[model samples]
Target: MKFDKSELQIFANYCVAAAESMAYTLVRTAHSTFVKETEDFSCALASVDGLTFASPRTFGATWYVGLDYGPVIRSLTDYQPGDVCMTNDPYSGFVATHTPDVVMWKPVFYEGEIICFVAGHIHNTDMGGAVPASLSRTLTEIHQEGIRFPPTRIVDKGELNETLLSWMMCNVRAPEQNIGDMKAQIACLTTGERRVLEIVERFGVDAFKAGIGQLLDYSESQSRAVAKTIPDGRYFFAEYVDEDAVGGKPMRIALTLTVDDGLLQFDFSGSDPQLTSSLNVPTGGHPRHALLLVGLNYVLYSLNPEIFLNAGMLRIATCEMPVGSVLNPVEPAAVGMRSLTCVVVQAAVFGAFAQALPDRMPACPASSVCLLNVKTTDTSGRTIMASIGPVGGGAGGSSAGDGSDASGANMAFLRNTPVEINEAEVPIRIQEYGLVADSGGAGQYRGGLAIVMEFKVFAPNTLVTARNRDRTLFGSWGIKGGRAGRTSLFVRNPRTADQDILGNTDLVACQPGDVIRLEGNGGGGYGAPFRRTVEAVERDVRRGYVSRQEARERYGVVYEDGRVNAAATAALRADMAEGPVEANAFFDYGPNRSAHEAVWTRERYVALCQCLETVSVGWRFFLKHQMFDRLAERIAEGEPIDGVQIVFDLFAELKAQFPALAAQQARIKQVA
Candidate 1:
């Protein structure tokens, strides 16, 4: 069968429709709330070479699309009909599908030759790990996190591999749900395989392959055209994660973007060293995960919204990550909570582009994905567990307008998980859920507002895992004179009763009637608050996104009786003098790269990072911070007046004296 241009277009549409249909089936039949309600899954078709050919237009996987399935595809070369290759090892190329996501890949054959691959990924409720839910911020290694599968064939020649199935069942806590979802993913791929074969039968294999190439080529061309429109230049930006979760040491993410001649390069050479925490990112030919940058770029450019997301879009871009860094961790590194790092990575990219294209880019958005896992037992003493929908932060203010309320920047497509579903599934009650008024940064174009959610635990010994609790110092920073957004707050109660502040944790056992309130961070504002129009301030007050006090203090506008007091506002504005914008007032988790440079001196901090290359991942995080803190303490004590350089020099000398450590340092430097 041969497909002409017209037929090729029709076939392409059909393929996209098939993928969407498969996703719909999985969602309707899936067991988890993350999949059914939040829709945190994706299905796509890949060429025999592992390049994505077609993906669903509606649903987006965090790090699954734009991925090259070469490793998984190659592992399944011997696979016959009915064979399914499955893996969630972030290191082997399935980047950070560590838990929740069980990826399934099935090869489509034509005339006894592999022609295409159908892959579907769904977020399972749980995969066996140390914690009840899969995400553990304290996981130090992959073994402690969950079951590991290297590109193994779970189904052979249409037969289920009972040995592998048994192993999975033994490992996971919710074996039934996991296995059921696994079968659901397989069914999705099977649907895609059937659709692809139908197209192959209608159009000859040669024409089908040609259409794939044409579609890829078209996407590549459009991406390059958009890239060319932006002025070619180099941009540098950095963002920090408050900590690595297990420890209080801030992690640095430095990015340099060099765009020239329609080619964009992202270099992540100066990122912080990998930690023992579960925040590490696994590395492989992660084309899909890496294409997160490309997807973000597309959203920023607001290009033709439909380029048919494929591997071709990445042809105009490339990413350079240093091995053993947090962004590209080595083997055995835990990545259970990798999405936390991804939010920061995306912000770093946005920050870099903001430096280059401030007019086109908006101020920094509140970039935290709040995941809360509630675990308890039912009346029968059977364990009951549920993962609440991940809460999204507000979008940053853009040049044209202020940010929206309780929305994510660059990812406005995602929606909040409904309270009804949450109430029905978990042992909790939603006391209050709404937007945090006056949380958005004040400016001419204010940033989006953050969300406020309060929940009461109904079961005894309920375990709760709340990540990214506060964003005060770590909250999104504004550009120009725009003020930073209010940092996130996790409080038990406020102004009335005893309330405990929550920290990022692997688990928290709670008693019944304990209330947990989450106040998310808002995005940074774009321009001066006083410059904002009176009408905008009035609108914010009416909408309950801003209070009258904020209107007068921040925006220099007065609101009375739901109307802006124009004369008072003018007088306030006239009385206010141009001054430095308020700096970010938030908690510093620990010594960030910037703070390290500032507090310990840039040269000293650089020397410490160099020394860190010599030590093991575990020891470096433990000893270096202690040593730096000790040195700072000594300095504060006025102990090193005469022999300051000697003290530093002696420490360096001792580090160099260890031959094994020196050799390890050499190896690390060579690898880096």
Candidate 2:
């Protein structure tokens, strides 16, 4: 190590301060409500090799601490002193996870030598696409998502490329907002460059370079030290997204976390193939990609809060994603809703780690965040596109205490926009916005309650896209003997004669006076509900977080006249304790999942995967959907399902249905 402990600490603080300053500049000067208020952006200082060493710790999204800019950096040619490169293409280097997340980076030079790079990304509200927000689960391909920008120099030698800038703005709905946000990003990078130069001037170029390397090494050591705390073993867990596409069946994401000594490997081999929706995650096969390790980052921070936030933390971990899988989809595959898929990945990682450390881990959080966007017209009839803030649900309960209410948990970095801001910006009326009672799962450490948001739009033909609306069919799973959380609900014209229930539907068309109500899923509980004290249940009822009926039924605690009946509660708990126990009491995946799994057993899924592997990437989702439909029909008729034989039969039928696949039927049959 070139620098001593004290010297390295000072250098690290300086770098962090620089990154934080960049974030401050961006948040204060940004135009969009998503950026200035919701805070869905990040800033970091990376090494010359594009390894993030320092990022804003207390501001913006925490999902990019280990974001690698190396791919985007190497994609471009020789960099001038003031060259600022940009890219939003998911297939190009995987730096920008989706089209809406516009990423930009500027090189910092000292004495004709590159010292470091300043980089960050902001979530644009609109980027011309099929939907208003450029994101929807219904979108089938990347072309439908939005226009993409590959790695190129948006700012060449400190001068803005007017042609490139104009070309980008001409394609989006809100050109003014997008241009303002882009300029704010450039300003942020400029702030970072100045700060980096200051550090080099204060510490000398030699010490600054040496100290940066030592800081990464120190962070790597901290991560390894935390890994040593957990027992070395393989922990496997699987989670599901409510829908594969619009009105589609549930999709599975399997993870096997292998912890050997101080090293960790996330294997996504048994996961489902790429979907025909925008929920795919474009990782580009990078082992330490930010999307794959987003969940791991939260886990490491929860285990040891002192661990440094940088690419070094991911040094102890690597990822194995099957090619053509949801996590590593091929080019042209839609990835607008990758954030939603990443949440499921987080839940799977959390589930896997719970087995390794049951006492310390928390139950599943509300694995969904509904990002609502409104496209309406004013009185003059001009098109107006606005984002109505992200309404996320509660976090799961842990040993420490109850989970947080209305928080995104792992994605808590996405700050919510105030109702005042939303109403003031867009022509909409905010009706009801509060917590839902009895939605949280009951346990010793009770889960957090869900959120309810209802709003009315006055304009007719108002288009609303609620991307990432999930948990409508299956709720968040609980751990130990705790109960599962409640499922989400989305409705139009609620409590009216023309009310309509929409389940996991992302796009909606509304008429005047139509009220849209969206209720997010609650967080799962930890430990046993019977173990929760009577006082906790009574307090929850008094606070309106839990209903009196829920207290009596779920928690086995009786409440009379706004007070707990001690004698009755004790008797009810005793009676509940004597009831039949679940076979695998570790996880409580609600009745919906339990029933679905009963029909589609693990053996059936294994057989289905075997059949899928025999088909091409383009035909996998098509064949999977056909098999699912056939299985549902057979189950409804009470007919026995031969899982293995059914897969082969479906393949043969599909081959005959499509003449293009007819020639490959023989090869498929031979492989099967």
Candidate 3:
């Protein structure tokens, strides 16, 4: 069963190829535009114990490379050769994370014995809920998001579960699309079964199992090697979601990353408590939850691109997520918009790693990706649901070079649907789709440019939802004296007489002739702007990526007669170097965040967390909001504020006003 390194490498390639083939099967045969064109799906091969060993490198979403299927597999009492299990309940096994994402797995048997499993998931365009797409930050409960399925057999003993399929079809808005996509997933799993059997026949069942173990071990070793290169220390970082919901207060995600020797521990203790909105992430408090370590995956890949992609790669890291926090919410808490929260999670991890590996890490990326979905009717009045492709933001600038323009950094797997395909399939007209000039932050290496999408709907009473629209208020932070990126903007009838600016609004009712425009956030810059060569700035202006005015103001690059003025540019740079710097010399979080943080400092945040720890989960979010309102009032009244005292005083007043709250607090005290 033992094999040399060269042999292991060859076996690894084979497994990867199998996973890639499975991914292609799903993409080519899927029904919805979200799955086939956008490619918002994943496929992997796992051991019988449910630890993924191989996944596609260049296909599908990379979020599930470290997904653990053990909990769900064990929940089933029995499995047959043709049995395929499916689930979308986040609380059931914490596998799907959201209702729209349906996860499926099939037990692969070779020679009448189980050897491995083939698994994957696809994002359903619509599942029938309060909103058209079944996902919105405004949704307050999981039930509002969509109907959920627990870990159950959709296929048993090679027989289709007609009853279960009917139930699913009845609940969803687009039954045909869902059923077609499900069949494609089944076909993909069948392909995986065939390919896995081929591997087992060539290597023998025993040797195949042994090779899987060795491959996992090799991936773990590679991750540990990368970890060892990072300096040992506790790096703390915090990021904020624009708001828990539309027109709501901000929700913070804090992290304390401790790296000792070659191991890493991420403690998300100071994060905000579970919100009433769907932004909560349901992880079942698992230490190695895939959502918590998505940023770490990107970091490790950046550190060592050759590192193996498997569950073992994530084995080096562990997360400590508070039970009631946004990162690990309890059941019944809506998780429809958990993907948006994970963006902030990724940003927090990247921020922490930037401190530990300052030289290696880039500035913060535009961690916002807006998924645009349209629910409109045809001339026949039949309901139609389709995704109009994702509008992703720019990547952060790095020491190597300027960041990629209008690129999806972490969520790059969700490919953009072509304009021709979208217009043909959906009732919409694509007016403009291109990058915005002067949108990226200025630095020695400028950040990537943001995207601008303008589309007009053709039907009356059409519903559209732009999920995960963020970074409008607080832009991506720039590091090493660089400037923050541009903020996002959403407008209806933009540049017209009736232009309505919709900030962070996910759902909207559109009439015919309504032109909706979405301008996404840009990536943060790296290093100082004045340090950038004038030639580079001029080139950006020439390419229309940066405007001449912005180049002069932000980068101190002067232009005269459509050419760079070397003498004047040097003078401008000299004057710009003496400008007043922000409070944090290392990070430029833009004026909006800087103004917000000026009041809500670290000490106040610590005090807020300490006070929230005393309250029960049900009372935590309410009490925190009340305390924040009181703090703001005190600030406006021109009184010196003490965060701890303010929170305590507010809690005392609230308890006295509400007898039920006082009784609950007494009961909690008695229990403690």
Candidate 4:
């Protein structure tokens, strides 16, 4: 408020420009294609208190608006001017949710005192692990994924620590690429430092400092105003992930959102326990850990497009996560596939808001990603290690419009790694890459189609590691009479008669000329399929997004020669008879999920999860696996089993064996 309107505008513009410039430097100097092509990086300018006050709007990952710098910043007691701290440890000062993302922070000083900090986060190509890419869906612990770093001063007082840098390189397979990427992070930070200094020297340090505080306050106010508009009440929604990557049994996530007086609280106490798989999210019990509110802030930003986005938005909501739950797993738990978990959190938040603001929300989003790594050999007997893709998943339908196509709505920041780059870098040929036809759920506003991609191996003995894969069983649910999106599929040798469906396999060895393909299911629809116009169905058929038979069956539409047969369509629609919907069926989750829920009702599942707390932490994985395997067997045998009693027996057996854990059961939901 101290400066005039024009002066304030100038300061804001300068900060944004500086952030964008930092991102530009990172992309241009980056060694890994993950940074240059996929653009999996973020940059921001934080005040001395470690609150992000400025970040680029059009560049970098957009989730930092929810990140916390206090945990890392408060621990740096020995910092000096020009010192840079580097970390990738999720439990340490890395602040990143996973190990693949290396975060670097450099202090920006003015008048020999720190005024602000510039930070950059980039995902390295590899960090030496059980698998090549350092991220495996089946990895049981974080230690197996890669070497981790605490907040170490890699650059002290303007001098690079060569010894420390070399030590980090010793743990990774791609030393040159990883170190180069780390240097790129430092370069971005240095660029930001120079830009911030320019602002301070031009506008004076006092004015620059005041401007930073004002900008943060301004962003916070914008968030508060938006929250204030929503009705004050409690909203609850329970959703399920496809499977606990180690097995095929579905996992559940419960959300309770309370909005009162322009403030929000998100609670995840009833969610399933932490898995042995790598899909857990180590949120460290922080409400504003940057990943929890990715969807909420996305909605907020969409509502107020011109509002400023930064850590100040963290002031909008508070979260309470049960300890040992999948979202708040203890240290050393594998958190490589956390983005998949985040997709559920995002959906849950959307569901909560839909209760208050249905017009603003979309149908369920297709949730899953496929990133495959191939290790093969060339003609000269030299081995070539390469990657396939972090394939884009389809997004859900919206009340305002149709959902996004193959590019996920929540992950619009992620771009496909180009096909040309993959072919050039490794011994694989692109057999097919296109949209999956008739996969999207039908609605008045149809859901977008999923992208189907296939590749053929060219080497004799190829080791293929599926770094992250999911959505093999249950699919995205629809809302307000919409249908559920189709689930994801991973197939091996799809072109041959003896094709095999891997069903989200973790790792495998493929021989020469083997083909593998992935079908990322489309987003769910937003309304009744029969309500869709005939013209739209005809166009969909023309574009190969919908088959003619599917158009007639799902939509009750008759089209010929790319034209709507009005008389025939009317008669067909009049006689169309579909299965009866359940009582007040606002959500249509398709048959697979509906069938699963028939046996694993909300009360039964939550009670079972709570009882499992009596089992010791070390034995919980095996016990849960046993329970799910039994349930899967019953489903496979076309028989109904007492899921609640099955869990009770499992818990009672484990508790009786280890009576010491019986008392620990009281600790369940203590954090709630």
TM-score of each: 0.90, 0.97, 0.98, 0.93
The sequence of per-residue lDDT tens digits that candidate 3 reaches over residues 1-672 is 887999999999999999999988998899999999989998989988899999998889878888898888888977888899999988988989999999999999877888889998999998878998899988988999888899999999999999999998998989999999999999999999999889988888898999999989999999999999999999999999998766888889999999999999999999999988999999998899988999998999999999888999989999998888888888789999999999899999999999998888988888998999999988888877999988877888988888888787876457888899998899889999999887788888888888888999878889889999888898998899878899999999998899999999999899999999999888999999999988788788889999989988999988899888989999999998988876579988899888788777877788788777777888888887887787788889999876557666777888888798888878878989
Candidate 2, residues 54-130, lDDT tens digits: the string is 99987899899999999998888788998888999999999998999999999898989888899999999998888
Each model's number of backbone clashes?
Answer: 7, 0, 0, 1
Local lDDT at 210 for model 1: 80
In angstroms, give how far residue 180 of model 4 lies from its true place. Answer: 1.8
By TM-score, the best candidate is 3
Give the per-residue lDDT of model 1 (tens digit) for 390-498: 6657888878899877876644244566899888777678888988988887778898998888898877888887744436447687765566777777766554567
- Order of models, best lDDT first: 3, 2, 4, 1
Cα misplacement distance, residue 418 of candidate 4 (Å): 2.1
Candidate 1 TM-score, C-alpha based: 0.90
Q: In candidate 2, where is summed lDDT lowest over 10 consecutive residues?
A: 660-669
RMSD per model, one decimal: 3.9, 1.8, 1.2, 2.9
The true-versus-predicted C-alpha distance at residue 485 of model 3, in Å, is 0.8
Error of 1 at 449 (Å): 1.6
Error of 2 at 163 (Å): 0.8
Residue-level lDDT for 584 in candidate 1: 36
Q: Quantify all predictions' global Cα lDDT against the true fold.
A: 0.71, 0.88, 0.89, 0.79
Model 4 CA deviation exceeding 4 Å by range = 1-9, 380-383, 560-563, 575-579, 629-650, 653-672
